[model samples]
Target: MDSSLYALVEDLRGVDAAQVLSHGVSSITVGAAYHRARDVTPHGRTRVTFRQDGIHFPPGDLFDGLRLLPPVQRDADQEPLKALRDQTRELGVPLHGWAVFLHSTTLGLAFPDVTQENCFGDRAAPADLCPSNPDVRAYAVALGRAVARQGMDSVVSESLHFGMFGHGYHHERSFVDLGSAAEFALGLCFCPHCQARLPGAETARTAASRLAASVLDGGPPATELPTVLEDYARSRTPIVTSLAADVADAVAAEGSSLTFLDLTGAVKGYADGRPTGGPAADSAWQIGVDPSAVSDVVPSYAILCYAHDEDRVAEDVAAYRTALGPDTTLRAVLRPGVPDTTSSDHLAAKVTAARKAGANTVDYYSYGLVPLPVLSRIPH
Candidate 1:
């Protein structure tokens, strides 16, 4: 089950929440480090919770001497994670930590140099930290170590890859109509670190800039770019794979495992859950996530199977299973509520499908986001 500190602390109060979560799930994955959001908690003490972009726990010495440091949330004083940990331990349930890395507007705003700079030399999405930057990599390692040291069985790493152009910003406004291809080109980072690391960076930047400019001048949208774009995307894999390896090593050293969460499935199925594509895994390259390369480094992987259809969920999981191979652990994350699930039976079917298709474990999307009754849809 996926949950949040606010949900455990304010909604069900530590013990009761842990007991409730432990019912139909093998383990509870709580948000230890998260990004900014104002979510409506249907069954929470407060109807809505405004979460700040920061780590929920005190990072004490974890980020010491690092150029980039994580911001601590105000609710850290309540020690929600600690309380949940204690409750879960008594209940004989494993607790995992969910950490959102490389996607923080607070850190980006504080240290603009670490944020991704687009081809036009603009920090369009200040929330996205360039993974190519050494400081960002160090911060990711430190975050994994800190969360692992908190007694978490595994750290579920989210947003550890690059961000897209249309997302990750607050109140973002763009009057110009840029198609998906153009937006993607604009999202490509041309920062100093990326330029130094990415091969043919100058050529790729020029091509991306021209593509965006052509679209801006009322030209029809182009679906594909020059071969340089393909080469540029391929080159980003090594950077992300290396970062995942470092985080996995850090987490392993701290006696915990690392599960890299790929958001490609969520992006494809979050809306209607009727995604029409080859497979979510195949499209992960757009975000700099190479599943096969990451699997070689990280032992476990998690993919969001947000589709309503059991077949769709199975297809997505099967693709990841093929990419990661049989040895690597694969967890399928499903949403048991509207747009993705119609009822308990529907959710159960999806779960069974995912397992049959090679998912080692099945996890629900969230606790507080949906109604209390909706959580019952989770298959035991």
Candidate 2:
């Protein structure tokens, strides 16, 4: 620790800085998603899934595609149990205590009601959790506390909302629910809870479309376009982050820092060419997907995920740093094996390029797939 940082840590030995700025730039982040989950069979050691769940959850979500930490290790005495703690203190890496927030896909198999509706108001479409439900919140809070007590320096509150694989892509022209959307529609949550918490979700969704329409054409942003979109962002993003704040608070109250991880994979595609199809609603959709929103929420730490690429990934990191600004903390998550076509040189270059791109911290996704020895060569 730097002299100043040491003094600060000493001064606030037990401070819940999840509510304040986090420490350090020599930061690193690694998730259970980066390793293979343990599996067993009656006859021999068979491959087993350590992921959150399988197909048919979250309306096209696949946690299994990502690595899952072995459930056994989460218990005391497991190698990972000590390793997780040692890694953080030794390396100054904050182990983002991540859980598929309200993502009950796997848990839902036994606890059916755990599913939260999609932004479109359909609960059956995918496995999520009802944020309005006290039960879901309680369970997540319990999980958060569990991780915080495990010597984790920071907590990364992931999946803390009502969304699925195709969040805005499924928006209807005039449709408000998940499955139903009108041509110019920007799909939004008319969910009972959302309506209860923020009555303006519907109106804001409408305004988003109006603004989108103006922006699509040659209409000047000086008109109602910019104002409407800005209102939608102000109304929407903070509410979601506030909800995230609540989750972080649960963990922070136990003396851990809470970081917010947004789904960057989706954002990358959208920036690339994912259609801006309907209404002036990109910002509204961004409310759920952007790193900039992470800063708005007051998370001491922010995680930015990006798909593998030559140019796009670095550019994504650069833009992320600019958007998150200096006050907020940020982490860059690079998905290393999704394509598996990258060369050794490409991987090394990407890692170096990410830090140069201004990522305050760095982490990798999808474990066993990264070729352990090759990954071991990475200088964390």
Candidate 3:
């Protein structure tokens, strides 16, 4: 079985790289474009031992014209990526660069015009970047090449698609009922670039407003609006696919492959520990993700199987395998602790189910986030 573990730069300071390989983990996916890391030293919890820092790696020369945000300020001696890559290579374990592309509070706060604009002409989400914008796409391509140049054999892409209202800002309060239609409506992006491609954008915007108002007034949303809104959402599919192709080209040029993770399953119900079906399975389209269309362009498709039940995890894996088909690599990511996982045996069962469901590779959600004992939960 091909197994890989995800890690943050903070993990390297406390956990030994040799220990990770000793656990039968053949590959390590380190955060390259991560937003933040809360470090916990080996010593017991103390005020001095805890610290939070954003931007794991430093900015390089390739990001000159990208109009991107500068990485979190660091001391002159900090060099996390180079150190981790060198140690992992010496241990004979491949290092895959983990990156978050579109979701950025830093960039959105710095440049609000490029952030997603909701139906009510609200630009409150500073975490999401509009993929339709030329500048956003250019920056993503540059980031892809930069990660590859850092000696990563492959790159894992996250948050590259459309984002929901709850993604960016913190301390949110969605007091209204916000039925399914209203939720989708509230998440739609109607920025200038989005409107340019959507011919019926005004009509869709009106429908979203009405649906949201009805929910806010303690009433059910009209049924007809979801279909209309979905049509508008689907219009952005080609643009998303184009951006994926551009990033793929960039990664290939630098001698690395791209593994695009489809977070739709988690969005549907996997994260809630429930089975996903019907319209929820297709919700990836709302965020401009048509996995089937982009399967040929990217080398691998990763499915987020954060569900509780092993059987449902297998079912989700099977669905992704069918969507991407046999030609593309299907990787499944599982959470080994917290709400979904109970014990190592339970984690092992989920891993077995993923393999039986046609997963080409199985990777865990994170390393530093989980306790040292939980690392034993991974199947060898």
Clashes of 1: 0
Q: Write the per-residue lDDT of candidate 2 for residues 1-380, one digit (tens) a residue.
A: 21001111111123332211133223323232111224221121223334323111011121233222113223233334245446446655444444445554445444444454343344442344555555565655555555566555666666665453343222224222222122122323445555567656667655645544544454543232344434543455555655676667777887877777665444444343222232111333443444566576545544433445545556666666677787776666654433521555665677677678776656654333334343433343
TM-score of 2: 0.61
Q: Is candidate 1 or candidate 3 better by lDDT?
A: 1
Instruction: Output the lDDT of residue 248, model 3.
Output: 87
Error of 2 at 276 (Å): 11
Candidate 1 residue lDDT tens string, 17-76: 455664477677888888888878887777797778888888889899998888998778
In candidate 3, stretches whose alpha carbon ends up further than 4 angstroms from where it belongs are 36-54, 73-77, 221-225, 269-271, 278-281
Ranking by lDDT: 1, 3, 2
Tens-digit per-residue lDDT, 1-380, candidate 3: 55788876655665566766665578888877766334443322331233222346666677786776545535313867777788888877788998888887778888899999988899988878899877888888988888888889898888788887655664478767666677778888988988887797898888888787788788865444567888888878888888888998999999999989787767766446664564323567867898888787898888788788898888878867777889999888888876678898999899899899889888986776666677678767
lDDT of model 2, residue 7? 11
The local distance difference test score of each candidate is 0.85, 0.45, 0.77
TM-score for all predictions? 0.95, 0.61, 0.91
